[model samples]
Target: MIQLKTREEIELMYESAQLVSKTLGILAKEVRPGVTTLYLDKIAEEYIRDHGAVPGFLGLYDFPNTLCMSPNEQVVHGIPNHKPLKDGDIISIDCGALKNGFYGDQAFTFAVGTIDPEIDKMMRITRQSLYAGIKKCKVGNRIGDISFAIQLICENAGYGVVRELVGHGLGKEMHEDPQVPNYGRKGSGPKIEEGLVIAIEPMVNLGTYKVKFHNDGWTVTTRDNQPSCHFEHDVAVVNGEPKLLSTYKYINEALGITSNEEDEFLYNFMHD
Candidate 1:
């Protein structure tokens, strides 16, 4: 069942979400050519712990890592390793944090250095699709509204939206009710309501949407061996509108990027 959060509970969740967002910002500065994902993972764990929140992904379901680091063709759930990232490679770092009995989850695909223009465009489109989906997360809309929005954008661009993986409602648990898929028919699925918080993620592949599981039982990669991009956000419905609980300001600052793309989704409390 979907557990709607109370106002106080939502406040606590905001704190948890910010912690994860901050962790991603720190990783942003460390993501570069010659940097190993395992090394970045270590730093992320320390940073999250130092801030008084536990690393949400480490040891969860016996998976060993503070972050899910997937590069290039790998879709998600890639385990951290000693392999150093190279120039032109893009890595998707999905992070989480547990604080005050709540969980915050988010992800971003970062370019190690200079990357292929086509790959870069794919990333941009995938990230834009995330917001498109978020824009539909209102009190009267169904989950399918959000899904269809994301799917239409990426599909029109000739990108493949991953089917095996889907976004989920989040609160005390990392994965909760209301699976948010990237593709669906409109007016279908559960109706969105106030106090409902969820993670909307779009995983788009540059080639076919078909993916294969690796033998490690964790990593997932595209069957056509083409690059993929993933972007995510934590959103909540309040006062009949969608409000963002996480911000990319830190990441953008680290990358020296200036964009107000998220301005429409920022909640009033975010400014305070």
Candidate 2:
């Protein structure tokens, strides 16, 4: 069953979401050549705990890391290791936090330094597709609308949209009802309804859409061995529209990137 969140519950989730947002801000400044993902993971774990919350992904399903640090061809669930990041490599940093009994999860692919132009373009397109999907999340649209939007945006850009992994409804638990896939026919899946909260994530690849799961039972890498990018956000259906509880402002600030990509999606407060 799809669990619809009350406004109060969504607000609580928002607080946790914002903490992850800020945590990303902290990581943005630290992502560079020679930095180990495990180091970053420790930083995130300590930061989340210091703020009175638990690292949502740590030990969940017996997984060993606090964050999924996938680099280049690694799509998602990349385990944090001592291997140091190199100049021009891109890694997707997916984070989660548990606060007030709710979970907030978000992900971003970063350029360690001056990355290859083609890989950077993949990152840009994948991030754009995330918003395209978010635009379809409203009170009346079916879940397929969001799925199709994401597929169209990335496929047209010549990027591969991951097939097996999908986003999910989120509230008291990490994964909830109503599977939200990146590829679906219009009008299929559950209808979007008010008070529904979901994590809309798009994992796009530079080559084939197929993926291979590592034997470690956690890491997932692209089948074509081509670079992939992942972006995510937590949103809620409110007043018949999708309201984003998480913000990318921190990441933008860390990278010194300036854009109004989020203007249309925000309302409650003024933003750059």
Q: Please, what is the TM-score per model? A: 0.98, 0.97
Q: Model 2, 160: alpha-carbon shift in Å? A: 1.0
- As for model 1, its CA RMSD to the true structure in angstroms is 1.2
Q: Which has the greatest lDDT? A: 1
Name the regions of candidate 1 deviating beyond 4 angstroms: 270-272
Q: Residue-wise lDDT of candidate 1 within 1-272, one digit each (tens)?
A: 99998878888988999999999999999999999999999999999999999999998998899999999999999999999999999999999999999999999999999999999999999999999999999998999999999999999999999999999999999999999999999999999998999999999999999999999999999999999989999998888788888989899999999999999988766443
Which pairs in model 2 have colliding backbones? none
